[model samples]
Target chain A: MPLVGNLRDFALHDFLYLVDRGYKTGSLMLNRPSTDDAAHLYFDKGKLLSVVRPQRRERLGELLIRLGKVSPQQLAQALQTQQMNNARPLGQILVEHGVIGQRDLQFCIQQQIEETVYELFAWRDGEFKFQAGQKPAPDDVQSLVPLPVENLIMEGVRRVDEMSRIKERIPNNDMIVRFVDRPQEKAANINMTADEWRIFARINGRSSINEIADKIGLTPYAVSHIVFGFITAGLVEVTRPTGGQSSKAPVAAQAQRVGSTPTRRSAAEPAYVEPPKKSLVARLINRIRGL
Target chain B: MQTVKMVISGAVNAGKTEFIRSISEIEVVSTERKATDETRLLKKETTVAMDFGRITIANDLVLHLFGTPGQRRFDFMWEILSEGALGLVVVVDSTRPETFRETTRIVEFFNEMRPAPYIIAANKQDKDTAWSPDELRLALRLPEQVKVVPCIATQRDSCKNVLLELLYEIMETAKEG
Candidate 1:
């Protein structure tokens, strides 16, 4: 079990290489070739656990362009025009500028997908490394390829459901939720009932069950029932928040106990401030001042 | 006429302000002060918002160079500065290897901002015991696409080379799009 430095450090080719070789359990640490900053990629039985590229620090656009969705001219013009106007992306710009038609752009994107799959398939130089459990289906081309945006968005929504459940149980201040619900997934799952779907929709990982229930005008009990249904469907699972502590405080007496500490005083005092009361005449005058 | 937004970023005390001053035609406005922390050992003071410098490269091309604040606390300004940047030039102190993290963070931040093209200038390359561009690139683990140029920001020729590399990256980005 020799560990590689940073999975992120590996190029797309290297990542595909490990997967093709059937190396199931290992982490790939990725560091920029000329910088100290690094990111990690955890693989569980050849499945991606998570990719943690810090916020505001990944070059997804570069990757997208390299994949050949748009030409360099399109990117440059988009960037230059964007600097002046501050509207739209290079992809959109290409479409607007009539440099590349919508159909051509879409075709290029589709080609990029096929190319990525081909690259992943050609991971091994020359070896057929198959493992014991669940041999990947030969025709099941989906597994070898990167998940589509639709699938990734669905996974994101599922995680939000799990997060809401854990937040309900813990109600701890350390809980800070990051993922946004996938609207595309919600659009796809239109078959579910409105109320049932509302539960999933409201569970954005940032909102607790109670908060979600309040938002959707459902009782906490009703929300829990809908949540349980989602869990039974194998759509979600519970896990501790990624960072050691949750940012939200627990809703019970624990808040009081935590508040008792001097260090925690700074965290609690902000919520306790009271607005000064005004007399009825003063209130009326204040309201009338605007008129 | 096309306006190209360019960001200038580097580790603290890496002559980011002075670099801007050397090239900028406008008066450099900054609060000059003594070194406050270990960052001071490398250089002193910090850019708070973003240091803005404008240059007209050609009749139709106006390059707006935005310098970012070096400290981690000012990391938030990166998003604001990089809104529509065509590329970034990350200045590095070849003399101080420890500032590599700060430089990396800035580079990462730029990558995330918008697929803005970027180049790294191993600033102060004229100084004692400077690492070669290859060594710096290997040590920093920069992406293959990113160009790292060795230069002394204080020298006009060195600064011109750094600017030229950035222009080259920007042109390449344009051609690729």
Candidate 2:
């Protein structure tokens, strides 16, 4: 019988830690019940061979085209070959057609896999099932590599924490931001880093924080960090969309708390203490083995 | 060279893709995949990422249109797709009251982001059971200053008018700025 439980009982990170320690091999399936989106993870000897999130599928050709690695015409040609049902994968079709190099295919695969695992941490409510001794086919395993679940836990937890904080400030992606009057002395000494400067350049009364993040080549969370700093410094004011007329849109300050960036604790502050290891590991193992 | 980005968002099957296709001079690049949830009952596919299209109004002016998935799970993409956009056009299925509620969330969601000027596209106006523009505004609890334009997203003239309205808003904003 498969081990099953709600994520609410055992969080994904703690669950992953147990899997890593036991050196177990099997398939772990997760379903966000409400959304009906599912994730499947195939493992061999405690190493992750592959993970499939069918809903988030990005074909190699499309990934290449989006990254500017291949042209649309080239991708179209590759797709035509893939449509013939020759049992060849789309990535293989692109490689055989010389549309994209072998190296590009490998890189895109890693990018795709990493993105899939990274997004999994956002599952606050879901059902997870682990079936022991179930693995992908041999040929599929040949292309698969054991992923470092621990590293994923470390990064995923960090990202989720930071994203939650950033979102509290940004609310959504469309609210508009404009420069506010700053003390001339402080303005001259804005201590602008390269990313901050890039963001500062885009802070006209029109482009949104999302647009500014894109311009600054940072994630929305990172951009929010910088924007929140500006807000605290009284160097910027955020407002709602004016509908292209003179400023009649509502001000973000007066709007919902989601719109304004609250000043957070300084980095110099103390962090939280970790829970005792033995109890956590023992509890996770019991949960994983379906206690 | 000038490129104006406008976001087209709405509830599931509000016809954001159709709206973009109608006015786009070039082929739209869409990343629609099979719907795996309750949305599958409504349509065979949904846009997991975004839909991209472009129109060239003049040698110096071009408009870029991005369409967002309507489902709430993809709300994360709304922020991603709405970035740098000059304005917004929210499409609503006039026959579906629940869709208006979704539109309300979208309007508030975007408003929270950066209050960009937005207009409601009261789509499917040609349908016999579709609600009137006034009814929709009231049901969605929209303020009076917001414009609600009735449209059939599949029709070229209607889509074009939405684009024109956005452009006019952009021009007026530029004058004010």
Candidate 3:
């Protein structure tokens, strides 16, 4: 029998605990109403076997590179070899070329799974359903160790707390975080993660959070995660953009590529925006057809 | 003065940023980051939020071009940006047939959103492997009213032409409205 209910009635963490305690083998799904996207967790018995989310297809090679397990040049070389012979997965190619060990690839996969599961903690309002007796394919089980639900719940709570802290300081991606002057004594003892330091070195005030992340070769999420820590510690200042020049200046300054003096919008041009309308496209098509 | 806000949307690496940069009078404001997962395999960086760019017309009209992030996870941004926009331009990489379904879904998503008119820019026409406009039209199964214009997003003249085609459609849409 399949169990179905709103997440409001039973929280995701509770549901996960129930499944784990029951020692059941099945797939648990959450339909997040906010994004209209669903998250699927496949389990074999009491242990979590894997996770599937909407539009999430993280490649092993890419995840490895992001985690600093392999260099970009090494990935390129492995890719070239794969193109020539064209027989194996990129992860296999990397291992065969000796760019990364099998153990490292396994670690990245595990981390990917953990991150995917942790992300679901953000979906507060959703419908959850569990269908029993469903199992993942044998191939999907490759090198995957059974993840205990106790660990996931604890980690998920930590991530949720961290995320809310980050969101409080960083409203959206365009908001800029600048390095403020730190007291000399406090600066000496400031603890910073590898990612935090990388983001710290690039904070020039003019660059938005997005630009800083691009320069450091990290995702905005990774950068923001660290910046959030800095914000909580009073080590950095986040400046909310007023939706205009403060946001556009850095781009304009760096855009020497534009080649010539570009004129701004003339005074006569009004920044008028239309009101939102549902089924506007369908209406236009009908009006155009004179139907 | 007249103005239009058109969204430039497509799958990752379909050249949404490049297309905006090709013709915008100023540097484009982008919310791009290093691709973390499978998407990074195709391109090193991906847009997470929205990209802002613009072009000026002779009649004192400013076209505010907002480029929507291509990845499906950022689909919510598409809804937010598409609201109140006069038009949309769906740019698809003609060289990659696999991205067609995503492009179709994005187009349909917008069509369901509002009464706004849109054009499909069949980008990467410079590459020999790219599909021609007619083949692309059939593959996408677009209605006869929607125009499919072949474009090379990196080329200034090509990008300008595609925007011009969209401009015409917007004019017709305004006339009807």
Question: Across residues A1-291, which tens digit of lDDT does each residue of candidate 2 receive?
Answer: 988997778777877787888787898889897987888877667666677665544444444554455666776776677678557776677688887777777766565555566667878879999999987643231232467677778988987787677567666556677654322233332344434545654566677765565443444556767887777665666777677724321111111221122222222332232222343223322322331
How many clashing pairs per prediction, in order? 39, 10, 5
Docking class of 1: incorrect
Interface RMSD of each: 28.7, 27.0, 17.0
Residue-level lDDT of model 1, residues A155-197, one tens digit each, is 3344445546744643432322212121123222122443553
Pairs of residues clashing in candidate 3: A59-B38, A280-B114, A280-B115, A281-B114, A281-B115
Q: Which stretches of candidate 1 lie over 4 Å from their true place?
A: A1-291, B31-50, B58-61, B175-177
Q: What's the lDDT for residue A59 in model 3?
A: 47
Root-mean-square deviation of each candidate, in angstroms?
26.1, 24.1, 19.6
Among the numbered candidates, top TM-score falls to 3
Q: Report the lDDT tens digits of candidate 3 across residue range B1-177.
A: 334467888877888988888876654345544435656524323325445565554343445677776767656456556645777889999999999998998887777665576899999998999999999999999988889999999988788777767766765645323
Q: Sort the candidates on TM-score, descending order.
A: 3, 2, 1
lDDT of 3 by residue, A1-291 (tens): 799998778887888898789997898878977776887788877888777664443344445555556666786788688789776667777788887778777776776677677778877789988999777543242234677888989888887888887887787667877644431223333433334444654554556776766555555667788777666665567887655525533211232321222322222343344532334333433332331
Comparing only chain A of model 1 with the true chain A, what is the TM-score?
A: 0.23
Q: Residue B176, candidate 3: how far off, in angstroms?
A: 49
* Model 2 clashes, total count: 10
**Per-prediction fnat:** 0.00, 0.00, 0.01
